[model samples]
Target: MTFARHCVFDGSSVGSEEWCASLDEKDKGDWSANEAADYAKYCVF
Candidate 1:
């Protein structure tokens, strides 16, 4: 869940699209496709 913490939750505000978008430019710092999919499934969906 580190990806979520740093890229999704650790923003100045949770769910901040601008913050998340900034971190997303780093490609979540080495997250795998499967992990991203699972986050999407459990957290996003």
Candidate 2:
């Protein structure tokens, strides 16, 4: 996903509730912000 794709998602990281909630606060935010595209590529189908 590129910046345009990320913007399409409106900055919200979509994923399993358990997985998202399991992350530490700071780590989660960073992961969501910095690696959202890569994360989605690997984590999602």
Best by TM-score: 1
Report the CA-based lDDT of candidate 2 relative to the real structure.
Answer: 0.51
* Residues 1-45 of candidate 1: C-alpha lDDT, one tens digit per residue: 988777767654433555345446656657678646654554462
Q: Write the per-residue lDDT of candidate 2 for residues 1-45, one digit (tens) a residue.
A: 786575555445445444444443436555655456655654556
**lDDT of every model, 2 decimals:** 0.56, 0.51
Query: Candidate 1, clashing residue pairs?
Result: none
Instruction: Name the top lDDT candidate.
Output: 1
Lowest summed-lDDT stretch of 10 residues in model 2? 17-26
Residue-level error in angstroms, candidate 2, position 21: 13
